[model samples]
Structures are given as C-alpha cells and as structure tokens.
Target: MDNVRTDKWLWAARFFKTRSLATDAVDTGRVKLDGDRIKPARAVKVGDKLAIDNGSDAWEVVVLGISDKRGAAPVARALYEETEASIVKRENDSQARKIYREPASTIKGRPTKRDRRQLGKAGE
Candidate 1:
C-alpha cells in the first residue's frame, strides 16, 4: 500500500475538479479518513475508509490502492471500492427526487403572430 497524499487521492478518485479543490476540501474538513478529519498532506494507505461530504450527496469508500495522478474510469475503479448498498440508496433517492418534479405546462395551440406581438409582460 502506498502512503498517498490526501489531495492526490481525492484528485485521482475524481472527487474534486482539481488538486487545489481537493486540498481546500481537506482543509475545511469536508474530507475524512478512518473517522477523523485529515489534512491535504496526510498519508493514506490501502484499507483506509474515506468519508467525503460532497454537498448534494455524501460519499463513502474504502481505499484499495493509491495514485498521485488521476486515471481513467476503469483505473480509478481499482483505486477505491464503493458499497453496493450505497449505490442503490443514492440511485433510489435520485429517482424519488425526479418523480416529485413538476412537468412543464402544455398550451392548447400556437398563438397567431398578431397575438404574439400583442403579448407582453404586464408592469408589476
């Protein structure tokens, strides 16, 4: 297991848009390892559990390997492993959110050009 930098791991795992952002997340305690907040330069090894609060959804994964550079999706997949239950719950929550969304209104027919010209936002 490589003693990997927290910022680098986050970037390699596609958790942040850039290494700097990853560092910022670490500094702010948005990223955690083994149940404790870690610094941007902290070393991580295989079997370490990472909990990341990424705004919309939280992420939890176990480190399987380490790399300083971001890799392809398949390569990234080898770096850490996510639980099946986490994936299922996130998917179901997403679907539920979508189901409750309001659809757009449909008009009966297109308006004439004159009607379009006459239509204007009323002064509030």
Candidate 2:
C-alpha cells in the first residue's frame, strides 16, 4: 500500500514486536511523524519522516514503503531508511552505554537468606 496506519507501519517495519506496543509508544509521545506527535491511527506515506524513542535508543527514519504484515528483517528494513545522522548518534549512544554500564547489571543473584538475616540485624 502507498500509505498505512502509523502503528501498523511501525509493527510491519519491525520497530516493535506488536502493533499494540507500537500504538502504546505512539500514545505516549514516543513516536512522532513529520516532526509532530501523532496518534497511532495517523496515516504514514512514503517519504514521511518519523522520530521514535524507545527508552535506551531512538531512531529517525524516512518512510520508503508501507505494509500491514510483519515480515523478515531484510524485508521490514525496506519499509524505511535511517538517516545518516541518526546512525552516528545511535552508535555514539551505544558506545557511551558500553562505557557506563548499569549498576544493576553488576549485581548477581538475589541476596541469600543468610545475607538477608545479616542485613536485617544490621538495620536494628
């Protein structure tokens, strides 16, 4: 199709695992079309620009095709083209993330029962 619902396009393009997830992102202001925030049902046509923020990462893409059905990564990739600046920025962000790993990731399994007891006694 020449155009499709924003959420459907997002899902078909493999941006989100499901249409509902894409719709939720759109509703929450995480997705924008043509530089303006839009509803999930908004129509997206080829050449339209989109900005998507997915917590740890963001993307800026130009729509190249429209489809309602999800497909392989290579096929889905044809639906949109990422901008050069977006690619550079994403790479920089990824590098920064690697250099500054989350503190939570360093923590191993949950505290043992003995550890919990010690913590409770220490708090007294």
- Compared with the true structure, all predictions reach lDDT values of 0.79, 0.89
Stretches of candidate 2 off by over 4 Å are: 106-124
With candidate 1 superimposed using the best TM-score fit, by how many Å does residue 32's alpha carbon deviate from the native?
1.2
Q: Write the per-residue lDDT of candidate 2 for residues 1-124, one digit (tens) a residue.
A: 6758999999999989889999999999999987789999989988999999866689999998889999999999998999999999999999998998764464468977776676678669
Q: What's the residue-level lDDT of 124 in candidate 1?
A: 20
Best by lDDT: 2
Clash counts per candidate, in order, are: 0, 0
Every model: Cα RMSD to truth: 8.0, 4.6
Question: In angstroms, what RMSD does candidate 2 have relative to the true structure?
Answer: 4.6
What's each prediction's TM-score? 0.72, 0.83
The true-versus-predicted C-alpha distance at residue 77 of model 1, in Å, is 1.5
Candidate 1 regions off by >4 Å?
101-124
Per residue, candidate 1 scores C-alpha lDDT tens digits across 6-75 of 8988899888878998899899999988779888898978888888866666778888988988889889
Q: CA shift at 33, candidate 1, in angstroms?
A: 1.4
